[model samples]
Target: MTVALMWEARAADGRGAELLAWVRRQDLAPAPLRRETFRAPQDRVLVITWWDAPYDAALPELPDPPAESVTRAVHRWRFEAVTDH
Candidate 1:
């Protein structure tokens, strides 16, 4: 089975670059099979990590950034791949 974890956050005013840099510096002990990052117009940063594990298996996820770096709590979601694409 394959699972994808999504994490999104909106940075504090004028701190988008800082937030993105912070996310880039994070390291996962047991890295995911694949990982990607993106940014949006509203100073939002998104990270998605793919893992070769069951949907309900324990997985490592990125932790929240420092309080002052974000406007609010981060958002996260998990999905299990249903196709071989």
Candidate 2:
């Protein structure tokens, strides 16, 4: 089975680019089968990583970005993936 890790953050005003760059440099432990990022309105950043593991398996996570770049605390979520195709 594959598990997905979802990480999200809201950047402080005018800091979305910096926040996105910081997150882009992060290393994913155990290596993900796939990964992607998205930018949303209101300076939001979303990162999704798909790992080759059981739904209940433990996975590495990206650390929080610098305080100066974010408006609020970061949020994280884990999901057991269903069929992708």
In terms of TM-score, which candidate is strongest? 1
State the displacement of the C-alpha of residue 46, model 1, in Å, after optimal TM-score superposition. Answer: 0.2
**lDDT by residue (tens digit), candidate 2, 1-85:** 8888999999999999988898999988678999999999999999999988888887899898989889989999999868768
Q: Candidate 1 has which clashing residue pairs, if any?
A: none
Estimate, for each residue in 1-85, the C-alpha lDDT of model 1 and write its tens digit: 9899999999999999999999999988699999999999889999999999999989999999999999999999999989656
Per-candidate TM-scores read: 0.96, 0.91
Q: Please state the error at residue 4 of candidate 2 in Å.
A: 0.6
Worst 10 residues of 1 by lDDT: 76-85
Stretches of candidate 2 exceeding 4 Å from the true structure: 83-85
The number of the candidate with the highest lDDT is 1
- Clashes per model (N, Cα, C within 3 A): 0, 0
Q: Whole-model Cα lDDT per candidate?
A: 0.96, 0.91
Clash number for candidate 2: 0
